[model samples]
Target: MTDQSKHEVQFFTLHGKRRAYVKAGEGPVLLLLHGLACDHRTWLPVIDELAKKYTVIAPDLLGHGVSDKPRADYTLGGYANGMRDLLTVLGIDKVTVVGHSFGGGVAMQFAYQFPERTQRMMLVATGGLGPEVTPLIKFIQAPGWFPAMGVLTLPGIRHVETLALRSAAAYGGGPLRKYTRDLAEVADILESWKDRRTRFAIRHLVRAVIDWRGQIVTMSDRAYLTEAIPMAVVWGREDQVIPVRHASNAAALAPELRVEVMADSGHFPHKDHPEQFARILDDFIVTTEPATYNRARFRRMLRSGMARADTTLASVDTALTTA
Candidate 1:
């Protein structure tokens, strides 16, 4: 275990509300984004390693941790905008954004919207590129489940904490013993879920998923293919949630992108294979240059407008074909 004393956990205001985050080490800025239901603590192990060479900023996305969760639509774009605002407040002009699972979607959106502010990007077990969602996730998305799931708010129930932690481990195929070992932390996360702010965030996220179900298919057809961004993708071959197939599909869509597969790991490859993940990230950062905006590509995208139109038409074709 790394020395906890070496790192500091703090909070800052973004958009007028306080957001909690952990900052460690010193060097080039690296932003770490966690997936659904996970807080900044999920990246603790990796942060311990990366902090040695980089200034790591890991924030609890609104409503998931010690952050302020306001009731609003939690779209990928919304999260990206929040990150942009946070970076602006911190005066971080450029960042190597690392996103996992849902965070990957946020990272991609951020890079697309603010290319000038992003140095590079790394996505792991990300969404927004694939149509394959796991059975468990589908179950979560099932109608009428939201209201009952909201029952997680019943106060003073110690068992709810255990249940939440167990659910997280089971869903991602992580080591159960590690989660169970930290009873206090688990309790904190579960208790946070009961908070009104957190509950609002949860409801917003549920709606966001439903509303953006086909977003990736929609975005892929766009001319963003000229994304000259120095990007890399890492995924566990055994990823059950997003599946490994999407990794190939995403790489196919962006041929210039770099991808690495981690065998025998699950959704959280960074957690399951920290050393290898770190090595791949280190090599990419060392060798890759900052992405330069291509004016011609952007202009073509605007002139054709065919990308967006094609994406919409393709989606219609797919729906009819499937139907």
Candidate 2:
């Protein structure tokens, strides 16, 4: 409702299942992915700016927003596959992927599994690469937590959802006062929250996280950095959730990777600094070579490098123990 003239909400089916997405602008394709407990609306601020120069495709990942939520396994691989199907349905052979938080992990999987199909990737406050997850996230991801949160259905669920959204505004590293006053926005968020499937999908994500530990998937940082795909990483300097240390490791993984640290921002840099985020992405797209982005070779090199790095780290640990 914030003058969304540039965006048109649309829906399409990937493999006979319906999914909803917001399309805006008319230049090159740029797919936007949101984090957990969020839908396409999370990118509203950033999309407003990005639509000016790029054809932005912000989708409600299968179970998130207006999309069909099947009671099936919602692994990270499943999310990546769903994206691949969505792109194929939309006739998008190649695209620039911009992902935030959990979406960042999915974007990495997409690039790793289908590297040639990705033009470039920008990760913002991404997961998977970092070892430090916040205590709040750990609490939410704890087993059997969904049933506890289900108390929202008792009454005044809208009010409860509004409080949750407002609380999340703090996670954005911005003041929560202004966002809480928007009653209509809070109402929409509550409506989305009413979905039972969303809770199930979140639980599935928890299991996936446990499974992903010390395991290589399509979205690992090693894959993103070593892959021939041009990549950049943006982090909120004040990020309490993922922390800036992860950004440092990401840079080490890919020395050539462009890294930007946004001041006074939190996990959601796009929302906190839309103009700056857009400018960084636009510059990367313009300066990077599209043809050199190869998928298979990148995976091979990344895997080899990861093995070597692991051995080196192990040796360092042994030396410290002996000392």
Candidate 3:
């Protein structure tokens, strides 16, 4: 039997693209999804630990890491369906899906579209919960923004960031300012921007759900729909990107959602507090009951949604016909 915890990158042809992912262990399946402009590397710390008792599969999404970047749909639904196809090919019938940030949106869509295949769903510092997000993320369509960022991603990236930090510190801006200026977030952003395909893909990905103001897409409206799904919402109190308040807001939307706020952590709680994250995940999997997919119940939900849509469409059609 394989150790499951320690593993290397593997490839499988997904949608005619050479997709990269890491698979380990052999038990119940666990699918890990990463955030925007990120890949499977984001969950490096916690993957091994979780793999100890469960089969872990982490993919590089469609365009982010070493995966092929095709000019295609970047919507949550598209990504969700892509994952379903990938898993089907891999012979994974069901999985406990865990997602972080942008990946959280994909996780929810996965449960929504293929409830039968999702054993449970967990969101970490997820997006699509609220309208608010960090200013850093709302960098779309700003005048001169592309040029400025283009310069930053150039060679000597560290020198530029370092000199700026030193200048701030020398000007008596204090260590706090220097530390704030130098964060891993920038490094992560640069990682994707290093390649032209990834850079374009990241922009497309960000634009799909985010705007200059903040996140444009939201799951709050549908959060209540997950009542039948065993769900958990984990966030860092110090999350620098999405607000932790959204966690509570999401719980209110679905009272049954298990909410966990990792104190003394940031946006990347799984990276900052891997042990705690692993334990929380393990507990959730062990304690909560895996959802039983009932086709009748699912059909009812779909009908409910269609009924609402029909009402709106009827109003429009009636008005147009009268006119």
- The C-alpha RMSD of each candidate to the native structure, in angstroms, is 4.9, 5.0, 6.7
Error of 3 at 53 (Å): 0.3
lDDT of 3 by residue, 1-323 (tens): 00122568888886577888899888999999998877887788888788799999999888788788989788899999989988988998999999999999999999988989999999999987777888877874455556666777677884577456445534533435423432555555664475767766777778888877677776654654687789999998877788888886676567888999988676788977899999999999999999889999877876785665555545433332232
**Best model number under lDDT:** 3
Which model scores highest in TM-score? 3
Q: Encode model 2's per-residue lDDT on 61-166: one tens digit a residue.
A: 8777778777765777788888888888888888999888888888888876777788888998887664456565565566656776677644586567666765
How many clashes does each candidate structure show, in the order listed? Answer: 0, 0, 1
Model 2: which residue pairs collide? none
What lDDT score is found at residue 249 in candidate 3? 66
TM-score of 1: 0.80
**Residue-level lDDT tens digits of model 1 in 1-323:** 11243456688886677787888888989999988667887787688788899989998887777687776548888888888888887778889999998888888888878777888989988876656665544544556545654575576454666566555654543454333333333344456555656655765675566432433322365424436578889998777676677776666566778989987777777877888888889899999887666678657766666656565546543542232
Ranking by lDDT: 3, 1, 2
As for model 1, its CA RMSD to the true structure in angstroms is: 4.9
